[model samples]
Target: MFDLFKEKLADAEQTVAFGSRLSGACESPVCIYLHGDLGAGKTTLTRGFIQGLGHKGNVKSPTYTLVEPYELADWQVYHFDLYRLGDPEELEFMGIRDYFSDTSHCLVEWPERGEGVLPPPDIDLTLSYAGEQRVIELQANTEAGLRVLNKL
Candidate 1:
């Protein structure tokens, strides 16, 4: 099943509702694949999710570092950007497995770059530009994903 969210938000407050929707449905060790073209609101959406988890600092893409970690009282969130990755095998060398412990939530951008090494997604979010608006399509890849979609 699919659902769509469309509109333009000038700031993060407008985006937080959507983020809260996702965070409310979160369970331990979730993996979400974020797919979109450049300029899409992938990072913006992620920022909302981070805020939902009680993060108060800036949320930036880990384009160069490949991974940014966020720790909270109730959750561990990992934001990953594989834009600069030359190969999926590079993730193996980075000890990526060690990072995906049993108590974290993972949000991955450019998942195509680490296909083989990546964990199966619980939910998949696709963002795209819709004229001056932004459109997001969310799909559940597992039972947990479906539950999260239901929460939205």
Candidate 2:
């Protein structure tokens, strides 16, 4: 349930733990849209997920760049930060379709910005800030998403 993300991440450790589980639960190619305001811990949660999948680096938000792609031992994590995007069509210019050609896990931040150009997401992770805490809501929009949530 989204109520899970709404629960306190407390610190990076807890966030990482949750991400680790999420990573392990992933089975098929997935598209996850992260909805949240600025500084809502979307990146932090992603950082944990990447770590769980064996990625080692600074998991920074791809705000200005639009996308941060990573190829790990167990997963192909594409973190798309569309905050700087001017139009959904711009995704086409970036060869966005190629990203979905196969079995790769995608975690997109601000997916609303890319709209029609992007494929339907398996899950939607919406983050809202309640003061110093973050509220995350997970919506499994596809069969893949259902499996992830059900497993958790």
Best by lDDT: 1
Tell me each candidate's TM-score. Answer: 0.89, 0.89
Give the per-residue lDDT of model 2 (tens digit) for 39-102.
Answer: 7778888898888888877888888988888888756789898888999988999899888745
**Shift in Å, residue 126, candidate 1:** 0.1
Q: Name model 2 segments beyond 4 Å from true.
A: 1-6
Show the colliding residue pairs in model 1. Answer: none
lDDT per residue, candidate 1, 21-52, as tens digits?
67877865688899989877778888889888
Q: Which ten residues in a row have the lowest lDDT in candidate 2?
A: 1-10
- The superposed Cα distance between candidate 1 and the true structure at residue 2, in angstroms, equals 8.8
Model 2 residue 97 lDDT score: 88
